[model samples]
Target chain A: MTNNSSGSRFGFLIPVIYIVFLLLPIYWLVNMSFKTNSEILGQLTLWPTNPTLRNYTVIFTDPAWYNGYINSIIYVVMNTVISVLVALPAAYAFSRYRFLGDKHLFFWLLTNRMAPPAVFALPFFQLYSAFGLIDTHIAVAIAHCLFNVPLAVWILEGFMSGVPKEIDETAYIDGYSFPRFFVKIFMPLIASGIGVAAFFCFMFSWVELLIARTLTTTDAKPIAATMTRTVSASGMDWGVLAAAGVLTIIPGALVIYFVRNYIAKGFALGRV
Target chain B: MSFSWMAWTLPTAIFFITIFALIAALGVWEYFSPGGGPRVGILRFETTRGDRLFVSLLGSAFIHLAWLGLGGPSLWWALALSVVYAIGVFRFV
Candidate 1:
């Protein structure tokens, strides 16, 4: 009993320590966001001596600032929806069937995911500009698909394969149409997979800066791009920047929370 | 006549539309004819299309990172290598 209790206590300590380590940066960001700019630079304090919401207030009042958040949310949602929708059938195909060069084709798609965003940024800018799409939410959404689609497909395929082939055949024999079978039966069975995929799609599209920044200017600028404005003639608006940073983490945190159960399995790519 | 698009440009609109169209096309194709059973590959073990995809993606990430670390002027070589590696993964892995 003593040995087992000690082992359990040790395991508990590790995660507790890990959680603190992970949260320390976030805590610091929240702390700095509440402090005045001078106070942020003055000394290291665990908590704000004089707490204020002026930084958040500035963000709420400014069109440039608040619009950034809206633009970000819009594109991230569009990307997540697009990625999962596209990936579903592709994942189904990969999971359920064999086709000539299917393996090669799937690999090629993943190679797009592996390709560095920096490499594509210039070409994407040029391509979008050629068609007159310099700064738009849709541009960012589509650009994000280059990575998210492949990842979504990979994740969903794993989940799909776990279902028995007999179920598909049985459904077909029972006169259920393919689309009906897929939408009504297969999808619900893999609901957690879809959730996990959407979570990743949202997370990546939300946090990605390079492609998002490159693809937009003032009109559809993301919060990450807008955050750059804090470094100005008056020196860095450290408080406001910290506040913006804190705000950026909220969407991702909420997503993780909603899909918390599926995340571990999703990260395992449903193989486990 | 000229008009300023609101927070959206032609390319942005086209890009998104094209993606959605492609997805629709895939759905149509799937409706017409369904997929087939898994086949054995060059690898000793049998793998479905999805397993090959997972391996290839994981491999490609490493290949790109290595190419970047090796100080190359262009990733075209890495791209080429990735193609060969992907083929190999499909064939053997």
Candidate 2:
């Protein structure tokens, strides 16, 4: 009994240590963001000697810096919305139906997800150019959908399959039309699935850089792309760059915070 | 940094606004008539109005892309095709 208690006491230590390890770089980035460029380039310190908000000020005040953030949010939101909207029905089809070659088709969709973004970047660039959509927010949003849609479909399918077939039948028999049933009854039942799917879609589109950078130029340049400006003729603006990095983490953190419960339930197959 | 990158084209702004409007309209419609029950048409699988709308939008995107690839300089045919395709998806898919 004493051994078991000792073992349980130490169990938390592993996760706590792991979390600190994971957080070290992020902590450093936040630390550096608060320091002046000279201090960042000077001797290493555990904490900033003179913490300043100058880096953040530069980003907020500069249109090029701030607009990058706006552009990124626009496309990421667009991609997430598109991905989840299309995936819902596709996931329903996959979970509930037994169509010909359904398994093969599903696997094919995943293969698209697995395909490297680099291979498609040039094609996407040319295609969007032809459509006169180069450097546009929609271009990046649509490009992201290639991967996001498949992932959303896959995640939602797992959750949908967890739902019993009888619930669907019962809803159908209760004088609920298909759309009404799906919206009012069926969707609420699998709300966690939708949340999880949307979260993944948002995360993927938000962090993905290769295709987004390849597809856009000045007009729709994402914040990640804008980070390049720090390396100008003056030299690397370490403070501002670090500040941008710190700021970039906020939206994603907010998303996870909001969907924390759903994510836990999602991983546990909708069971708390 | 340059502010030139900050300005979005009018078309781009209009495009986004139109999409948002459509989504808002969809939400309102769903709220008022939450019972557009599923129906199986030519596609065999059952679909609701929301599902049909989604499918049509997706299909229209592909139609426009295909036109860009194989059709002429004019996109009017593609737009016409998309409208027809959307109607078909609403009626059938």
Candidate 3:
């Protein structure tokens, strides 16, 4: 137990350092959000002499800023829902069955995850334009799918493999239908995997800027795109820009807080 | 047929198709043939499954670059294909 104290101290050191590094940018943004333009430019005040919520008011009263948040939420959640659903059956199949072209197909699905958003920006725009889905929520959702689906399938497949195969056979022998078996038994087994996959899907789509901005212009524009509008003839609105950047972190942080416990082991899809 | 209607895009299309076909064939060969053990190290790294996964993903990264450089798919496609190839190793290999 003597080493326990040092081990605990070492452990605290990493997380404490990580917390400070992670929070510094966030703290600066919050500080900027409470200050006026003159204050932000005049000096680097640790505490604002006259803290005002003017930037907050600008964000709320501004239709563009407020609506961007709504659009982003709508598209990201749609992406999450679609990605998780498609992955479920595909993963179950890959784990449970020995089928034709299975390996080739699975790899093809996964390559979508590694793609750089910038390169896809052009082709996706053209592809969506041809399909007449360019400015819609569905376009963003589908574009996101090109990344989210493979991950969902890969992670969920690993989780499915961890489950015992006999479970499936037993249900069938007991006169349970495939649908009944999956709903009652298989689902509960993979619930943790599902949670992990949803978080990933949400995170990728939530933070992504290039494709989301390129594909949508007016009605469906994301907050990332709206963040671009914080420019004027004189210069940029640093306060509002920082505030928007701060706002972007809110959803991702909440999600990680919920999934942080399961994230690491879940990466292997339950293998480790 | 009008000149515009029957434009000759097939040559370029065929070039891309041939490259992809070759990569696919190599994947098939990798899976069907034996001796797929990881070549390098960590604490331990020498199994058919581990090598297949590593080679497949690594090969995929190259394939995507090739796809981008010599061919015309977007980076999103490359990213998407990386996932697809990783899954393929799991299911097939």
The candidate that wins on DockQ is: 3
DockQ-based class of model 3: incorrect
Which runs of model 3 end up more than 4 angstroms from their true locations?
Answer: A1-9, A232-234, A257-272, B1-8, B16-93
Candidate 2: where is the Cα deviation over 4 Å? A1-7, A264-269, B1-93
Which residue pairs come into collision in candidate 1?
Answer: A97-B36
Task: Assess every candidate by TM-score.
Answer: 0.73, 0.72, 0.75
lDDT per residue as tens, model 2, B1-93: 233333579988897897778667766776687655569888898776766776888788898899888866788888798899989887767
lDDT (Cα, 0-100) at A98 in candidate 2: 67
Residue B2's lDDT within candidate 2 is 32
The candidates' DockQ values read 0.06, 0.02, 0.08
Say which prediction, candidate 1 or candidate 2, comes out ahead on TM-score.
Answer: 1
lDDT of 2: 0.86
List clash counts for every candidate, in order.
1, 5, 24
lDDT string for model 1 (A224-248, tens) is 9888865564488999989999999
Cα lDDT tens digits, model 3, B1-93, are 123422459876795686578567656765686344334333254445534655666778797888888877577787687778777765555
DockQ for candidate 1, please give it. 0.06
